[model samples]
Target: MADALTGVSRALREAPPDRVVEAADRAIRSVLGASGTAVFVADYRINGLWPVVDSRQPEVADQAGQSMVQRCFSSQQPVRDGDAGGRCRLYLPLTVWGERLGVLMVELPQEPSEEVAARAVDVAGEVAMALRAADQETDRYRRARRRERLSMAAELQWELLPGRSLSHDAFHLAGQLEPAYTVGGDHFDWSLDDDRLTVTVLNGDSIGLAAALLTAVTVNAMRNARRSGGGLVEQAELASDTVYYQHRGHRHVATVLLELDCVTGRVRAVDAGSPHLMRLRGGSVTRVALDQQLPLGMFAETRYDLQEFDLDPGDRLFVVSDGVWGADPSGRETYGQRAMARSMRATRLQPPTEAVGTVMRELQAFHADADLRDDAVVVCLDWHGSGDREGG
Candidate 1:
């Protein structure tokens, strides 16, 4: 065990940026005495798992939905399965603090002794942490995980995001953007400060480079407002004002900004031109009807209204862009609010991360072969509170 870690440390210290994942794969496989190894990262869009490193193949299909990988990731436990021919496969999930980084698979030449199995588990954990740290230091893993090259617009939107999911003592939130490589100006941001959680879900009307810049400006303004101690209305106002003056006198941004007192289950939000917010509680979904407001940059002096509400325990709030609700560009068909409601209710029990994926899949299936003419996104926020506690 010590030797395994020593080798990993040496690789970590000397491995070049391009070979980090390859080195990790080699170390894990060498230490396990395995014929080969593969590492598959879970994609944020839930389109499929992506192979970041595999000794046998240059690229591999998304195998996360496969029985073994699913079992390991969902159960947060290692799985050992042997086939009828006595060939053994070991699937170990690499995760830290409940965030799944990827899965490590090893093809054992022979049944491992108890000691070897224990060592494999240790190596899995170490690799998970190493990937997380390496991801920050190098783009090797990022490049490997992506299925295709992103357009400039999609690249900007991707750069503006804060991963796909987050959780805290009082809440769990997850979000996904569609048309991964071609995604335009659809993005989400959240910050957990003490007991307060600030969230922003944004969509831009323009596409390509224009949509990307509008999203960037809108997100930065919202972040500035939040960090400056602005309330929900103020946050929306700042973003709107910035876009109004900055977008060549056009209202190019639509958004919903939220400030939640997680401890108290209180939420305050400003909804502009984005799709109406949907709420799921007790297995029922309802569309929130707030006063209509202009998209950011639409009106110079527009004062955004704040819709204040208290959530019950086990309540989920969902936000989606117009692209999702109106993916069928032809006015003849509608994804419709009721259909959206049904989708949310059906998947309310899943973790926010899985819930959004299912919803997106359903929506895409409904739209069939139609392309998303606009940027599409979904943000799911789950609050599990007593609804009676007061924030200190």
Candidate 2:
């Protein structure tokens, strides 16, 4: 098992960017004595899985196979089934540090023993790590994951994201954006350092490429400050000043910056403009009120205030942009007034990763399945609290 794993890792390291997946497939088949191997990656929308090779698109006709693959991906578990001619097919989820990349399907000569199955799971983990590393070197995996062409603005926004989800012993965090292919301004980002976690959400006050650019600048400014050992106040101030100098009061971005002490469930925040916060504790959901400051870039040298809050273990917090809560489809009722809360309640049992997506789906349904008029961002955080902490 060790030799096989080493061979696979060596192959991945030696392969060129575009050939990484092919190299992995060949190595797995040779090392594991498998008849066939394929890597399937979840599409951009997370609605379908597409083979990394030998297929131009996801197989829409193969409902059974698709379901099996989806199940493995969603549950982060290995699934086994009988293949043709007494062979056994194994679907192993390709996940790394809580991120669901896709699945690795292997067709073995026969059903494997428990040890072999365990080895396959380890191999899948290695492959996922390779894929994550390859992302910087090639766009092959990214292209395969996209079912449709992305608008320039959407491309920029996607590139600016820290990631779709992150997990830790203290918290589970996930976020999503609506109008995936053409998303404009709304964006979210986060960083974790030891027991401290920082999260930011931005709602650019513009549309199309302009909004994308605004968001990009603001995000980078905040990131720069954060990376320089700055706290919420510094991040907010630096971002505000940068945006203000760029647009000179003509453009602005509504944002919420949060810093959490993982051990104590203490949170400090800076709320600038439209992104709103809500908390779910026990069974009830209520808005988290913060001092609203001027949107970034609204004026030169705008001073921002920091607000403090605490979360009990098992508490879930959501930060949504105005595009979500203020969504008024065809002049009807706004989504935040009721539908959003109902959606949150419905998905309370789900992990943050799944809950974020479910909430976005509900938002779409509230829009009557119409394309969202504005870009929307939703971020969910579940605080599990730290084990070493004395009190909740």
Candidate 3:
């Protein structure tokens, strides 16, 4: 098993970023004596999976195969099945941490033993890691994952994201944006360091390319401050100042900056504008009332203030931009007036990974299945508390 993994790692290192998938496939077949191997990546909307390397003989071409692949991706578990010819097909999720990339399909000549299955799972993880790294060097994999062309603004916004989901010992975090192909003006970002998890949600004051550019500047400015050992206040102030100076107060971003202590559940926040917060504890959902302040970049040298909150174990917190909370179809009632809470209550049983999508789907239904008039973003965080901390 170690030798096979080493071979896979060596292949990954030797291959160019755009051809890593092909290299991994050759290594897997040679080391494991597999009949065939293929990697499938989820599309931009995550609505379907596409083969990253060979498309001539795609493994998931049929509906049944697609369903099986989707099951593996969603469940984060390996699935094994045998065909009439007595060949065994193994489907393993290609996941890194909590992020679900897609699935690895391996077709063995015959039924495999438990040990072989275990090794295949390990190989899938290695492939996932390689793909994650290759993402920085080439856009090959990114192109394979997109089912449709993205608007220039959406492309920029998508490139600025950390990832759609992340997992930690103390928390599970997931987020999503709507009008996926044309999204602009709304975005979310997070970073984890030691015991601190910093999260920021932004809603741009403009639309199209202008909003994308405004958000890009603000996000990078905050990132610069955070990387320089700054806290939430510093991040917000730096971002606000940078945006104000660049646009001369003509453009702004509504934002909420938060830092959570993984060990103690203490949260410090700077609420600069929209993107309201809601907390779910036990069975009830309530708005987390934050002191409203001017949107970032609204004025030169705006001073931001910090607010505090504590997250108990099993608490679920959601940060949603105005596009969601203020969504009104055809000038009807706003979704947040009641439906957003109802949607949250309905998805209470789901994990953050699934809950984020469910809430977005509910919002779509609220819009009567029409294209959303504005960009929307939703971030969900489930605090499990620190198991290693005594009395946590």
Candidate 4:
């Protein structure tokens, strides 16, 4: 008995699920001289049994074995009996952590003995212990995989950022990122030229790694298109094409691009499957809705229209990523467009940079403790200074 216990303990410690079940079957057959040995697990959904390992009857082994194992699963106790032909039929329930996992059965050669019954019980107990350990290990591996993906995404987000605040005489732009364990595919950029500033805010799909990669590629491509120089309409056309071709075999991004003339406060933009930019004038919020274009990479043939508006002094123009508009922090209630407009109007007197920060903070509070789907960017244009300047 001591030798059997020692062997079982060692096997339980060193063997994986498959090997432990195999070893237990061998030990039971050797000890009892049983004709066949079968190990079955419980399937709660079917209210039946499932054979994990077997020694005989391949054609209908699992089916026949499940019939007996299912019965043991409910009782969680041994079903020991002798057939009419004097063949010993043993069903030893397998349990661990106060839960019935399955059962092991052994059909003895002729008649059963006390020794055979004790050994079969030992085998069932040892197998149950091994399965519990294996289950815990599998759960650990799944958690690690989830964390690894999140880490990769967070790293990508940090790399794509410009980092510091950017402000000019007419407008000041700043953004804040909520703590996210996973990668979020949201970003914004504005480049200031002599008489014009090109601003863009984007939020791609929630595809994790793939979405993060596309966001980075599209951001760089748009930067290149603007630096390469052209008309506002021309830049939008080139940027749309660049995104379509760059993500040729992959996913796409939803974007909104705005061109604001520094001298005249003239605003022209194209919206590609994104929310409208909100403009606050005289304590009232109005949406500067542009014609919708297809999301980047969806079609090679989509075109964008250039909608223009003149920016008046004290006009607060706001552009934001979807994280602000779509997120629900309290685990309920999404922060919709109306909420965002209110947030903008409330902070109209503050500097554009600080106002953007306030909006991000409010969004974080609303979401309760949940992480955002993608990065949130709020760029506010106050059209500061004299409105008399004109150029470009």
Q: All candidates' TM-scores?
A: 0.84, 0.95, 0.97, 0.56
Candidate 2, poorest ten consecutive residues by summed lDDT: 53-62
TM-score, cand. 3: 0.97
Q: What's the best-to-worst order under lDDT?
A: 3, 2, 1, 4
Q: Against the correct fold, how does model 4 do in TM-score? A: 0.56
On lDDT, the leading prediction is: 3
Candidate 1 per-residue C-alpha lDDT over 270-349 given as tens digits, one digit per residue, 9 for 90 to 100? 88877558889887777777666778888786688888888777889988888787666556566755677778888855
Cα lDDT tens digits, model 2, 217-256, are: 9999999999999999899999999988988899988899
Task: Give candidate 1's whole-model lDDT.
Answer: 0.76
Candidate 2 vs candidate 4: which has greater TM-score? Answer: 2
lDDT of 4 at 318: 78
Cα lDDT, all candidates? 0.76, 0.87, 0.90, 0.65
- Write out the backbone clash pairs for model 2: none
Q: C-alpha displacement of 112 in model 3, angstroms?
A: 1.6
List the candidate 4 regions with Cα displacement exceeding 4 Å.
1-150, 179-183, 246-250, 329-333, 388-392
Model 3 lDDT, residue 124, Cα: 90
